[model samples]
Target chain A: MKKILIGIIVVLLLAGCSGGEQVQSKPQDQGYVFNYNGIPIVVNTDVEPVLKELGEPLDYFEAESCAFQGLDKTYYYSGFELTTYPKDNTDYISSVYFMDDSVSTAEGIYIGSSVDDVLEAYGEDYTGGENAYIYTKGDSSLIIITENDEVISITYQALVEGLN
Target chain B: MKKILINITCIVLAVLFLAFLQKLFMPKYMSSIYEGNLIEEYYDSDKDHDVIFIGDCEVFSNVSPIVLWEKYGITSYIRGSAQQLVWQSYYLFEETLKYEKPDVVVFNVLAMKYNEPQKEAYNRLTLDGMKLSKSKIDAIRASMLEEESLITYLFPILRYHSRWSELTWEDFRYLFNKRKVSHNGYLMRSDTKPVTVVPEGRKLPDYSFGENAWYYLDKMTKLARENGIELMLIKSPSIYPYWYEEWDEQIAQYAKENDLLYVNFLPLADQMNIDYSKDTYDGGLHMNLAGAEKFTAYLGKILKENYNLEDRRGDTKLAAVWQDKVEFYEWMKQDQAMEMEKYGYLKSYGAAAQAIIN
Candidate 1:
């Protein structure tokens, strides 16, 4: 009889343990959903609604440049500048340029992130000069522009072969 | 006396050798990337044109000079290249006036979207094809990037010196005389990549053309007026690149202020029978030969009715030139079609945009 009572208590404990496992099996918090038209808004994403999701920019205006002739308008946020095609400021966004550490990517990579952090997040399969680290996966790339081993800015463009 | 003769001979040999090298190194563009040959081919023309079109690929690929010649007797040449900027147009217009000032100068307003130099490669395509002159020098000054050197423009060997290994048989054959790549500045491709979905233009905070673009447009207007040429601003029927109403209004307002004729062809695409799917080759970005002819037919009517361009098909000299061009056009269309049939794609005709989304 005592053996039976002990077996019942063990069964109740197992049931309690299984109940706790359900909480652990709950869905994980997803990363930032940066996308437009199935193509990840990434760095060079130049469309709408994604801009709205990024929220209001800190500053926006036309950028002056001798070399950069196309996509004249820019939306300056805490950590990035979202540039658009034409200085008219109303068009498909051409390029999204990350500026500082104020904004973090879903992977926690930011402006001031260390090179080690990038390698840790994007893996070791990346190519660029010492000052620039490009982590490309298929057509989308997370290009980390650096200064003194720290990421200065992040730009995502289609790393199209032969375009450069 | 012997030493002097030897030195003179050496100098001549050196000049000939350098010229030969320059020719070899120059982009043949015969097999691939034919757009590279566009700007330089302008000088090859007879320079007798009733209308001179100046803009980017939007003007070159969209407007067919042959269609204009065949239908309206419009002898036209487009001094166009890929992503040509406004200042480049102004300079090209200036250089063009030096050769032949046509009765009508059609400037595509799309180039005005770019206020500054875009790329060295594109700049080379537009500026390198010119004969050495003050206009070329000024264009180089205005259009060059900071990293770009003017010496490369003067001596093309520097830019293409690395092309030594890339020399092909086409390079040798076309060294002295280049086969006409364009039909009087019309690059032809008969393929079609229909527009499945038209791109919608997003909202912009501003619609004003930049100060530099405005400055160049003003200069072009003044230059055209001085040369007794009527400058016509047109937004060609490119189904993509989304010509916004706000931009249209701005151009319209500018046209109103300056008393110039500005025609936005997006609205009239339907009336012009431009069904983007059937008409455009690479979707809606640019029209195929069918679309160009359709658009050109519509434009010819306008040029005749408004611009009062005379029919030059009656002129023997012009007709002789145009007849050959027409034959070449038919040949190019057939050749492209055959190429598509053989390779399942167009290797020539600048790859004819496999599928340019933007």
Candidate 2:
């Protein structure tokens, strides 16, 4: 009986401690994943493998990261842009931005789509003002900007834990 | 009665031991990542300044208070840190008003983009060195992330307890006495990594600033007015992170409505003789010592003409104090130049030094 009581107390202590654990979403989680040429591009994951799969980009730019010792690189594609942040000498995908209406999100929402279309596609589970709508799944967020009831920009961003 | 006295003595010793451990575990910021020590360095200053520059790394790495004093006889100090949020800047400004009231307060608008709390590491860099006060407490409350707790900041050992395994010689050496890192809150880097390719700003989903950021900015403006100080807004000349036209318009509109002086230095870089090829340290993000000198010289002239600030160099007492500062500034410049010449990179500043120590 005493052993069981001690076991319960230990379990309780662990459960209490687990309250502070942050939920960092993994790429395999049920978040929005952008597919390019049959290769799945996931934010917050290694960008090298995806780059290898996607082939060469139209243009590439890199700069020394702010307040840290690493390079922030961006790869421009035909319809979208892939940006990465450096950590431990490895580049991780931080965001993917759509440049034009040629490409749409996996949910069929693209630039020029009406606000009502976005509400129907992603549903009412969003947060933001009339100018922007943010749909978050785990730590990844799908940000959409609208002007005059038409979508103007679409971006998929990985919500990094620390300074980005 | 004897038992009770012994118990009390034991409790007191335990408390003292924990306090000592707390001091030991906290980062000394003596060697590398010197920006973390910028806040505490201000407490040791004379607190007599005509201008106070406040914001994130944009102000600390870009502007030089030493240059302002040497060239224009305008006394100034930069209360800046790495990725300092707008609310933290507001609280820091509130705290500064308690020590001294400057004629003008220049705020960099780069930090306005961040509406919520950023990294815990950055919060520590901005808040850890601050003395215990109401402003510090409020800043902690305003800046705490989801994983952060008030008690952890109150007793930093609670948060840094894991650092017991990572304690270094510098941590022990500077546990009691910390080395001065910044000159009037301006961290100097002599090396230059000139701008090669300037990247354009990405299309944002929303160009409008968050309500939380605006709330703090409004508070800052009102606080400056209440204290009888002129609030000047500036967008430092950082080529990256793309300051969009829409963002600039909003700030311009705000400045116009508030009747504040808003200067966007990115466009005026050429006018100020800021050559990106020779001026910047880490590409085009921040200015090296040479770049900072040029910018400060130009800014000092405008400040003098606009605010009618008197050149305080004529005052013998002020000149003597600044004389020591100028000498220290020159010494550090020479020291950095020698380091760059010998090692081809800074051995005492930035991540290279940290890597060597580790």
Candidate 3:
């Protein structure tokens, strides 16, 4: 009887420990959920939610929208400036001028995020490729244009992969 | 019966433990643990390649190995990792030699910006070469050295190891969402263009007859020659105006001293007719998908005409294995045409970025 009682307690403990293991979320799943221009959107949910998660970018534009824009391919995010190597000089773009600033009714709670979050999470690529940008990985492609600070139009090549 | 049960239990436990250990040490999947496993798996070649491209984001994001194989018929592999520096390149080449013996090595100089290699970089390079061991100490050592390895190669959890208690309804979205089409390899720039302004008369970093940068350049050349491999110093195109005078001067000097092949296509920005105002993905530092197509085409021609590289795509043996690359090249050409028609703007080809210095 005592052994049976001990087994039950052990099972309960194991279950509790597994609770922490189940918290993994893909970019398309949940990190930043929002409704942009009436489209239910989530960033970093499926894979690492790059800025492209805005869904065909509905007339939106950012400079560095390509695959290698910021964190994925730049010195700034490689823990280099802070932990690894210090650059001789560093400059950050204080503000971006997009031709269009019309907010397409950005709704949805961006929980536990800051302006830096938007920058690091999505804005880096947008801001970096401000002049001209190309985003490509494998066959997936998105071309973005920003005039002042507003995104213009983002057109993607529909030749996607692994759609079975 | 009791004795038999005990024996079976012991055997089963042993097998499970071994399997677990194998999964922990030499994981084949991409996750948090093995950061570069994805790259290694995709670019694995049984024999030595003709060319090996190494460096940081530029190498992986800009250059396509599949394109090289299809165009030049040269079996090339671009082994780049996120934020990879020169030191990491040194170790990666050393480790890659164990599997492949390439004749030519192209080292991107931008990675020279990295002063030294880090513990994580060192650990990944080291662990990628090791096989699984049943020893607990070895596993712990690997985990300590490169935590991502623990997630990628050994234990799968480290890759997907997130900090959520339970997934919400949003978790299911990935299942229904459309997966982007996988191409030969390359990311496309968005159409949203940014108006760029280059600072005039910027004091450029000098690449004179000799400098600190040249020291590493010499070291890489020596390393390549000692191994009987030819080295090519390449500078990929970026939108930044500085790439022209300052960056090109240094590359040219290096090429001149070593009699090495140096290709500087920056000044031909107008001649190449690259829509820098549009084709640049990142403020002119790197090319977008459109830019990569123009740039890679020039690179491929250089390899073909100068190096006497033969297109081995038709060779039965080479074709059998690299079949995907051949198909990818065809797809890339098709994709380019599709873009040209879709966008209604095609830039004239630039002077091919090629060199045969020696």
Best by DockQ: 2
1 against 3, candidate with superior DockQ: 3
Write down the TM-score of every candidate. 0.70, 0.89, 0.50
Model 3, chain B: what is the TM-score? 0.62
> What stretches of model 3 exceed 4 Å from their correct place?
A1-164, B1-38, B43-48, B117-195, B198-219, B240-248, B328-358
Q: Rank the candidates by lDDT, best first.
A: 2, 1, 3
The candidate that wins on TM-score is 2
Model 2 C-alpha lDDT per residue in residues B1-358, reported as the tens digit of each score? 9987876776676667778987998888777778878898999999999999999878898899998998889999999987788999999999999999999999999888988886666777888878999999999999988877777678776666656779999988999988788899998988988887665666666678989999999999999999999999999887866888999999999999999999999999989999999998877888889988888888888888888888899999999999999999999999999999999989987632111111
Ranking by DockQ: 2, 3, 1
Task: In model 2, state the lDDT of residue A136.
Answer: 91
What is the C-alpha lDDT profile of model 3 across B4-53, one tens digit per residue? 78767766765565444333333222212222332444343445467787
DockQ of each candidate, alpha-carbon based = 0.02, 0.25, 0.04
lDDT of 1 at B270: 79
